[model samples]
Target chain A: MTLAVLDGGTYYHQEAIYGERLGGRFDRTIYAPELTAADLAGCDALMVADRIHPGVLRGKRPILLDYLVGGGTLIVLGENSAQQWAPGVSWEFRPTNFWWWLEQGGDPGHRIVAPDHELFRHVGMKELVWHYHGLLTPPPGATSLVDITPDGDPQGKGGSILYDHCHVGGGAGRMIVTTLDPFYHHGSFFMPAASRFLGKLLDWTDEAFRTPG
Target chain B: MIDAILLDCEQSETGAQALITDLALGPRIDLVPFYDLERTVLSRTRALLLGLHSDQRYLASRRGQLEAFLGGGGTIVVCGHIGHPFLAELSPFQPIHGYRVDDLVVNREADHPVWAGVDPADLSKRRGVAGFYGRGSNPPPPGARIINSLGPSRCPVDFDCRPAVGGRLLVHAGADLWGYFGSGNSSERIMPQLFDWIAKPSEAA
Candidate 1:
């Protein structure tokens, strides 16, 4: 199946790197900076970074919501861009800006588990690290794969790391909002755990696309 | 009835407590412990104070809930580091790259409500003492206005703002304010003004 990635000039390097890594897994990966509904004609799945959003993709052109409704797998990243671009998805962007403090030295010290989940087939309950920009608040309809816990608190709702396949109409997509900068070239090197997690996500997305609705 | 305060649980809390406590803005502040945020933040609270550090996980989970709470007219105070991936999703502000604390030098906007009691000179003194790391790339949602700024970078170190989602929002990026709050000396000087701006009377029209 073909994977079409929406390009918006932001985080191009990360997408390119992801393309390279997922090369063998994907039959063909196309980068479309100015994506229209027509561009998604033969694509099996679409991956968008911080650039493209629902409003920008609306109108006569092939819209994101339409694509998902039409049975395509869509993955959107970047905390702020996702919030602005995809409104109907039902996730919120918390305004507690703290990227610098974590990079300097802020550790939540917790382990995340999606044990029986499809995404964690290769990566099980691992010691999750905090090194990315910020996370996404999961929509009510979506299922959470990873939850955040700080200092032995029983509730795991602080920092939600992973969200599972959320269905919108006839389409199905998985939204992974993370603070980990997996899109950055250095992200893979800086946080090896994130790189591994991303590989698993791409794999899961591919599987989700191939599964019957 | 602003009964409880909601502080963003992250490294900045250490910094925020320093600043808020020093200012003596006592409002029975509750630091949403990192582990139990959902329980603490989702209570029957009227007002919330968020001190965001540079932790991605904290921003991701809290941004949306805070928006919903604020949209329903909750009071929120955001301080320390700014700009997260989820910010664009929740508000109109876009995260632009490359604005840091060292870039600011003076306050350009003088007449904003968040700055009601403070002098322009005192705010200016905060320029060197306080520094912000992130610069918001997008314009503040239509009605929001700037109260304090670092002239050269055009980065807002302080703001008397409102979100497009319709909540009372206060944003401050000055690192020194955090340092001062944590130090606990000049709190009487700074905390009251902040509380006045954040803690609006429940009956005010």
Candidate 2:
């Protein structure tokens, strides 16, 4: 399966996408500003990661929508504001608790709701412990994979940290989005969990491409 | 007078928004997208502030322009790990393995205006949590004044390098220095004092 990753040219994106660990996994790395439908041809999936300028994505919205409608997968990572560029994605901002783990009997509040899902077959709850940017409520037909209880609520009322949306753009394609920014932490050499999560996510995508629908 | 030209990567992250807000309130820093640096006029600018989220690969590709700016007596302050060889003097960031709180300590090596009245302990921890300042080292260029070091090895995490033939360069191997704004601590002194230091005429001048 051919995978195309958008390159924002940021140091973190450069290291995460093209660095030693997962560089060989990507089939293409298109410069974000110059992205066109032609640039995504023959690729099974295109990933839009964190820290990409929303303006650039807004400019390429038409091309992205076209790709989605053309039966190609579009994966958007966190902190890029999917609502600004992707179709039918609703994002709401919430204050992140970066110091939750430091609190007494504290919990970061992340859990894999869809534990049996193929995406979590390799990556697990332990790998998604870092703080998230916000909550995502995708349009109907979206499946929430990861859920987080806001403010460490004992009631467990929260939003999805990761989700998979089907029939996006009214096509056979799909979009997988998550508010967790693994690449930023992985590339920064912080948060060992981010590295493990990213590596496993890449493996999952590659495996998904190989399996016939 | 303009304090500096911040290379904006246009990210919507909280830290990025905070930096933007801080600069907007000051109105002295010009926000230029990283991609637009090639076309932006910089010869007259006194300093360039490169954030932790900057596109270092793009910066490396446009190294000539940056070198020219520095050669023309322009300062460049970079905050973050140097993953790519963007500038000749910078090396890739090396992370400390199995580090302790002491390793994260901010050791003041020399006095400078940018760090005036800033307590090392305050810079060392944020809200009683340590390791928020820095945990790695971006080896400074030779002859650079080590302003702050981290860990027992005294790895240089912050330094001021005045290349023999160019203006000054300040490198901070951690979060953006400007993000410290409104933190109600001496770290808050960094943004304003940094610009003040940049505006001052060098001894050569």
Candidate 3:
């Protein structure tokens, strides 16, 4: 599948989409400021990074909305605010705990609600104990494939995570948003678990692309 | 007079923006985005803060302005490594070959008021994770006092160099120092230490 990842001038963004082209997942980076509707052509999925400037993204809202409403798969990773750029998404502020995995028997506080879901076929809950950008509350009817356990989170009320999918624009398109920044941790930091999880997630997105809606 | 002018940086996750909101300092963010930096704008400022993710390309090219600002007895604190020739005495950053949060052992080689009773391990972990405090090393400048280090890099995570120009150049090779104020950790002491050292050297002593 042809994947288009947006770059906002970070090493992590470069690695997520352009780092390694493997398993028929040929990822391309769409420079954040320069991305336009014309750049969405022939792309099966569009991935937005966590660290983009909200103002820059607001400028491209029209193009992103167009792609989402036309049966395209749009994946938003990281901290894009719900009130600003993310369509059908609202954000919740959670004190981030980036070091749960470093502790002995540390639980990252997240769980895969849909164990049998395609996303979990490759990656599991153990690999998700790293970090998340923020808690996201998706629109109604959206399936939450995973959730955060209060025990695993320092905040004691773990935020939503793993995978969230929702149909938009009268069910013509599908949008998936996750707080997981596998690309960044893997790209910039060379995190082993994040890399493996990211590959599986990308592969799952590809498999879901071929199956009819 | 501005307490500190944080250089233009990505405000969201990097914590430069959070420092503004959490510290009750508002609207000052508009005054220091590299373009707004001028002799007139900086003359009266007490401090100029540069985060790890600062606009190094813009600030590097305008080193003379910074020198002039320093000449006027301004406090310039850079929180992280730079990509330009701003500090001649300091060495370029050398990435740690095997960087692990555990491998990161904060060792203080010198004493500064900014670290009176502060512990290195306190700054090492944030929200349960480690290593955000310092990732790379800046070769110690002549007479530069080393404050923090990870493992054997000896790269100086936190240091102070008082160049012959009669100004202060404080560098921390990690996240923004001000962001620690609200982390609810012992590292929160960093904010006051930094501010006191900038505002009144005598009190810091």
| Number of the predicted model whose DockQ against the real structure is largest | 2
Shift in Å, residue B145, candidate 3? 5.6
Instruction: List the candidates' TM-scores in order.
Output: 0.41, 0.90, 0.72
Most accurate candidate by lDDT: 2
Candidates ranked, most accurate by lDDT first: 2, 3, 1
Query: Model 1: per-residue lDDT, tens digit, B20-40?
Result: 354344444554544355556
In Å, residue A50's CA in model 2 sits off its true spot by 1.8
| DockQ of candidate 2 (2 decimals) | 0.62
Per-residue lDDT, model 2, residue B73, is 87
Residue-wise C-alpha lDDT for candidate 3, range B1-205, written one tens digit per residue: 7567776643455656666665445434333554456544676677888765443444655678888777787778886554344756555555566687665667877777877777877876655566667666767677777777777655578877766665778887666677776666677677766766777633321
* lDDT preference between candidates 1 and 2, better one: 2
DockQ-based CAPRI category assigned to the predicted complex of candidate 2? medium
Candidate 3 per-residue lDDT, tens place, A102-189, comes to 6626666677777877677766776665767667665776777778777765567765774556577466667777777676555444
| Residues A45-142, model 2: lDDT tens digits | 99887778777888899999889888989889987778888887888776766766776255666767777888987788677877777787757988
Docking class of 3: incorrect
Give the residue spans of candidate 3 off by over 4 A.
A11-26, A98-109, A131-133, A149-159, A164-166, A187-196, A202-213, B7-44, B52-76, B80-94, B99-102, B124-130, B138-146, B160-169, B182-186, B200-205
Q: Tell me the number of clashing residue pairs for each predicted model.
A: 31, 0, 3
Error of 2 at A151 (Å): 5.6
Candidate 2 per-residue lDDT over residues B1-205, each given as its tens digit: 4668887766554244565566344566778877789999997578998988776767888889889888888888999888787887888888777788788888999888889899999999888777778888888877788989986789888988876558878899998887787679888888778778888848321
Fnat per model, in the order shown: 0.00, 0.68, 0.02
